[model samples]
Target: MTTAAMRVPVTRGYRFEWVKLVSQWRIRLVVLACWVAPALFVAGVSQQATLPVDTLFGRWMHATAWAGPLVLLGFAGQWALPLLTSLVAGDVFAAEDRLGTWRHLLVAVRSPRRIFVAKALASLTVILLMVTGLFVSSTAGGLLAVGDRPLVGLDGHLLATGDAAGRVALAWLCALAPTLALAGIGLLGSVALGRSPMGLLLPAVFALAIELAQMLPLPVAVRLALPGYNWNGLFTSPMQLRSVLISVVAGLIWALTATALAYLIFVRRDFTNLNHDGSARRAVLAGALPLIALGAATVVVLAVAGLGAGSGIGQDKVQRSLATAFAHLYRVQTGQLNRPDVTEAQLGASAACTRGGGQTDPEGPGNDWRCVVSWRLPDTTAVGSAIYQLDITPDGRFVADGDGPKEVNGYFLVRTPAGDAPNPLWQFDGTVELLPKG
Candidate 1:
């Protein structure tokens, strides 16, 4: 056979792989589930009497159309994302092994490299579609549940409908990196293990393990470097470029490494040694395979840790975040009270914050920070000042609780004209900036 005839274009194999993939009823079902399940979850959450305040935006399901996707993003990172990626990418190569069709595929393509490329591209395309389906369905569900009101963002800014939609969409787009990272691990399993079930199982286990590791009392740099944690940065107000970059860089490195290893293994396999019945395949570096995966994950974490180390946490940033959030939420509080014409500008909110009797520098995460908040009400010369206790985290999130019992800040319900409503000042969520100074 001519050399030209032996080397087929990857595009042909790509199309063939895609058709083979979509032809499966299971693939179609997975896509449908991605679209249907999130909407159902949002609908259910909306109807529940109690809100899920533990999640970032879960308490606001009835307040805005952006919360559903944000909630789903949090939920998925725990387990759904790994499972979602593995369902397809994990099985892409292993399915052929289980069906005893490797020999047939090799005969058709004659180039394992091209075949691997085709399958990888096909699986990734499907996974991308699945992610998109989730994004769209979640957003649709939020709209149905909440009727598209302005979103009070993490920073306490009131985001208009279009603006909230834009940020939520961008956040969803940013999720693609972690999805790809987990997918890489799945693909590695599919290629190395040659069992559809193992391929599917490994990535889910990887995700759970990552989540468990995050719970340890590890240093902030190490926690930030963990594979899926960077999703938090994507939703931060004004965007944390360093965190986003870490997510992308870590994901790309891990993905490319795993894919490259898989490609190398796939291309070098001696297909001519298949049994007569095409089922007696010896193990493919069984022990070394897992070691390789573990080593790759470890290396990526270390490299990414250095990147997160420079993202300084200090006093000024936290103060700015808390003060701004206080201003924004103060307006919300007044509006809830049926106070007329009370605007953020008119409120003139400001705060003076300190750490641990001025003994500790106002830097880093702590539970002992205090802030004295003061804001002017419309048509009032008196300045109302109240102390706020702050609990700050390395990720730039802060929960500021109102100090005085009479002051209505912290996670509490307040009386409004519409009836009992959430107090914007109570246990309010806000963010400090994490970008490294230029």
Candidate 2:
């Protein structure tokens, strides 16, 4: 007379969970928003006259359609990726408790592990869809609105349309690694907090903390271990294998460790209490302060890190990088001047860069980096020297100003035939590689 045990396949749980997820208006809205946001950004950027010069690929916004996706990629790395991951992963588990439905779901499934796996798969599927939608939308919108012109590469060279498109696509794919790591963090928060709002808030707070840590004077090895560093290689010209390797390894470690902890806790934690008496309100109130406090802390860190990533500049690398970067930019300037064609090879550039007015062995990041750059222009045997003042980031990005006034090759808004524009030589941007070269 006993009822036959309900025979259910594990994949059925996934199917059920996925249906629940897709049925939610909020979930649909999130996916739609991700797709629309990038396209909207592209449209807005296409209409704008001024460039977001400091943002990655920003200075090239009006110059090429490809800048649209890359600029958005940079913004996503700063915070959007974490926000999106948390929006889904942070709520997937906790929402069950918030609705007091965990017990019902457990009763039907008879296995907590099965339910966990189902929910996780559902969450990850949604995330993949959202990321893919945003990427494709951005690429399509940029090409439509801005036109598929060649892109300005990081080294100040022009990248062909096909090459730029491939790089942009690859950059988005590389971005997925850090995003998975973030999802793991959000997952643990959802399980531990057991309140949907708190779960979401927790990952936001965690991401802010990591952002602050990145601004600290951490070692390259330590910094590379953080999920955010994975995006840096995306900006490299040919892309660096070391960056991809680090991204995969670091992201995997974080995802596995955090997800393992979440799994253990989820499988064992008691759901008997079902009593959420005033817990949601309390969690909300409690989480509010942390978010505010962390946001403030992040701002403070940015201001300080803006001073420098803890004097991490290396003399030899800075010297070599500045010289090479200058030669590239010099070629750009010559082209703009309508001069005879100049090749990067013709600018045999060398630099004797020193730090802190020789007070320190060019060993750290600072505003006081000085380089006496010597380069021979085409048809000139004479090596001309130009003084450059550099503000270098620990990660090797720099904004360098040529010494003296505009007439002496100092970079002011140069008078171009089109109009006054950023002097390609005056205060141009560049970066140095922190990773070992092949």
Which structure among the candidates has the greatest TM-score? 2
Off by over 4 Å in 2: 1-7, 276-312, 402-422
Name model 1 segments beyond 4 Å from true: 1-9, 196-198, 216-225, 229-237, 273-316, 340-372, 376-383, 387-394, 401-403
Query: lDDT tens digits, residues 51-100, model 2?
Result: 78777677777767898888888787777778888888988888887788
Shift in Å, residue 421, candidate 1: 2.7
Pairs that collide in candidate 1 are 409-426, 410-425, 410-426, 410-427, 411-426, 411-427
Error of 2 at 190 (Å): 0.8
lDDT of each: 0.74, 0.73
Worst 10 residues of 2 by lDDT: 302-311
What TM-score would candidate 1 get against the native?
A: 0.83
